[model samples]
Target: MKCRDGQMIPKEQRCDGIVNCADGFDETVAACAELRCQSEQFQCEYGGCVDGQAQCNGTIECIDGSDEKVELCGRRILVRPTTEPPTTAVPRCELPKQPLNGSYSVVSETNTTQTDYVLSYTCDPGFKLVGHSTVLCIEGTWPDKMPRCVQTCQLMKHPSIVYECTEEETEKPRQCNVEEIDGTIVKTSCRKPNYYSPVELPYMHCQQGMWSSGPVCTAECGTLPPESTPLVLRGSTAKFGEVPWHVGIYLKNPKSKKHMQICGGSLISNTIVLSAAHCFWNENTQRLEDVTNYAVAVGKLYRKWYHPDDEPFAQKSDISEIVVPKLYRGVELYYKNDIAIVIASRPFEYKLYVVPVCLDFNEEFSNIQLHNGNRGKAAGFGLTTGMRGSESPVLRVINLPYENYESCLNLTSPALSRYITYDDKICAGSLDGEALCRGDSGGGLAFPSSISGQRRFYLRGIASTSPPTNDQTVCNTHALTSFTSVIKFEKFIKAYWYP
Candidate 1:
């Protein structure tokens, strides 16, 4: 015989109580009904055949159980006429028990001297089913298991918050439940201690299988004093907490075992400082300086390490690592891509004087009209006067007008103008002896930006280099200083800072 798919099989294999074709075409009802039974066998009503002696023997041999019907087997039994009336036998199935918080209904029923039923189950609101919804009943028994209804809460998904949970009696922390049961409580907190949430409490509750809202962690960056006015070496001295994000980069003298302020940086995160790559490069060695030789001081008011006024709020951390772009080539390329990230050995404790400044992640600061005389603030403990003057012991800030690339190029020295590209550098400061001088390298150029209905300082650039004076002075205070633009290296900064 040939199957529907053209596969060959033995003639007797068709309708032999087995499937010979992948689609079951050989055993289908229409095909099986055309089969003939041997003289010594009894044919079933639905098709197929059995031994003659196997029929009407008190057991079913046919697929439909027609071989054991009373109509066909009655002749084989001896009848005793003692009953007052003849009654037809009927088969019944036990009803399944109802699940808690759920119900079941008879979706269908059929009778042919016996009853068969189909049951469907459903859960109440805020509840979920755990198993198959329908079950079949056959001969006083259920063939399928009953389903269960359970109430639970889904796990919260947030970038800044983390959730921890434990069962009522367990001390071990468990994986947050995807479907936390009713009455479960979860504790939430920001991923970093320096971050905050609008929610007063750090707990969430699961009720009726649904979870309450969770807290969202937000970085408390760029906070400033309410009464302080926007105001700086030739610049005015800064008050305490005036520039909270500014940090002093120091190097320990190997011989004296004393730390000395070298460059300046800005705190972009609790453990990360943004600065100029040149600060960490050794020009003579033609390689990066030792990380162990560096340290960062936050909340610093005085350049002198022993200043009594600086100790109370000052926080210090050893440098664990220094990161600079691979394209940065000491001073050969004219300090192109001169950005660096300083990672602290330990996170600085955030305080009123140790907060962080915001980074222009959205390029909002870059789009501003710099040609309209918009100015930015630059702060450092750099030289207070001319190149020959002593470094300022106290921090000071100077407001410098931002200049467009074209104007900056015109003012730049002819020897250095070729290296001042618009994408990698920003031009700021004034030519009236108010520019960033020696020791101001790596300090931030901050521009005021409105964020969340508050005026906050966003770091726009890092002080890189200024043209040298025509005389013997190392720094020309009258030149427009070039700063490495923060917006240009946004991708590089985030890779290390966020990771």
Candidate 2:
């Protein structure tokens, strides 16, 4: 049927709380004034009726052409008998989500019609709102896409301070994954370490994209924790993470394909190590060892064989550079100016298990100078009599008595005597069958640190030579072992490390 304006209308649209004709003519005592319709009959304009097959069957049976109104004539149409909620399939689907920087609410799709939903978003603290204010709920979806409550942070008020999101510059293939609920965090800190802040708080909490609090600027130097001494062990298994300053030097011969423990060293800095020059430079041959396959293993208490389960991660570094004295010359079975500094291939991150030891860079070894009986500890992974030339599984240290300065020079090897001077070498002797042996060369001879109010482990000397074995399968006892005096070469250490 046609309305007064000659507009076509579907026969089923009559009296559907809608007017098919102008001036309320369709629903006013005409059209669909009746509450019901026959099964095969559909009411048309002005109470006219047509067969169901004539409705939207691609043909117009009504005089008003109401049967074929394009929509019903083409697409499958479901006629509603009442206003009761329409039947829909399983509605296991959830609402569309918004960004993490804002909060959202579901005003519709609450176990009701899958159609029509109103989604609204609110920006979090320290953030600004953007995008659409409200989302339209149409067919269980927002016809107008949900607005994003963009995360934003105010510029750092302090001009010298700068920050970047933690997730932004992190290196890939991280060792440990830390899940953060607040998402990517950008931390603001001082631009540089030398700029000098009272507190070195380069780290701060980041919520959303905004700084939760003002960026902190603290100096890194002044905030280091006060030094403390670890418990001294008496020839027992070194506890994991203990004696962290001790190091193992391994050398692999590329030509022979033989890898072996050549010497021991001490960690003095993140990338610097103080060890005997003999580990690399041979004084007798006046030639340097092939260092291409040399590496230092730190953070390991057990030597030679490390238990994978006990210490899963062992930090190893290749020797990138080495410094030896210009005047140094090789002595038969030993060398002079025996000290050297080693630079690591990669930067080291010092932790509890891998820490640098204190050094005698300022002639600070007063305890050794005070008495001839000062018992210094000499530790290494060298061979013991029980092992019969094999490297010790655990680090072995002996309480070696400091020999008198004058007596040390006279009693040491006749060959080293010409090279040894008053202040260049440190001498200590062991009474028992315990002494730093072949693999112990370049190891640190640790003494009680003498920094007032602090008792940190300090390297007294670096091992150079040991007496040959006598009456025992290992190094002989009651013989003086000479070491490269750390104090004698303090100028070299300070020049390179502190400078």
Model 1: clashing residue pairs?
232-235, 232-397
**What TM-score number comes out for model 2?**
0.54
Candidate-wise lDDT, in order:
0.77, 0.60
Cα deviation in Å at residue 489, candidate 1?
0.7
User: Quick one: RMSD of model 1?
Assistant: 18.6
Instruction: State the lDDT of candidate 2 residue by residue for 119-197, as single tens digits.
Output: 5678776555556655544333343445665555444444345655554446332221122223345455565521235
Off-target runs (Cα >4 Å) in candidate 1 are 1-202, 206-216, 232-234, 369-371
Ten-residue region with minimum lDDT total, candidate 1: 77-86
Error of model 2, residue 459, in angstroms: 1.2
Residue-by-residue lDDT tens digits, candidate 1, 1-499: 8865578888887765445565444554445666888899887664667668757776555544556667888765433322332275445776777889989987655332122565788988767777777665544456445688878777756645677876556657666856676666777887654466666655787877667766767766777766566673358888878888999999888899889888999998879999999999988876789999999999988997667888899999899999999988877877898999999999887776777888766754467734436787788988866555679989988887888888899888888886687779989877788798878899998888685687778788899988888885877888898899888897899897742
| lDDT of prediction 2 | 0.60
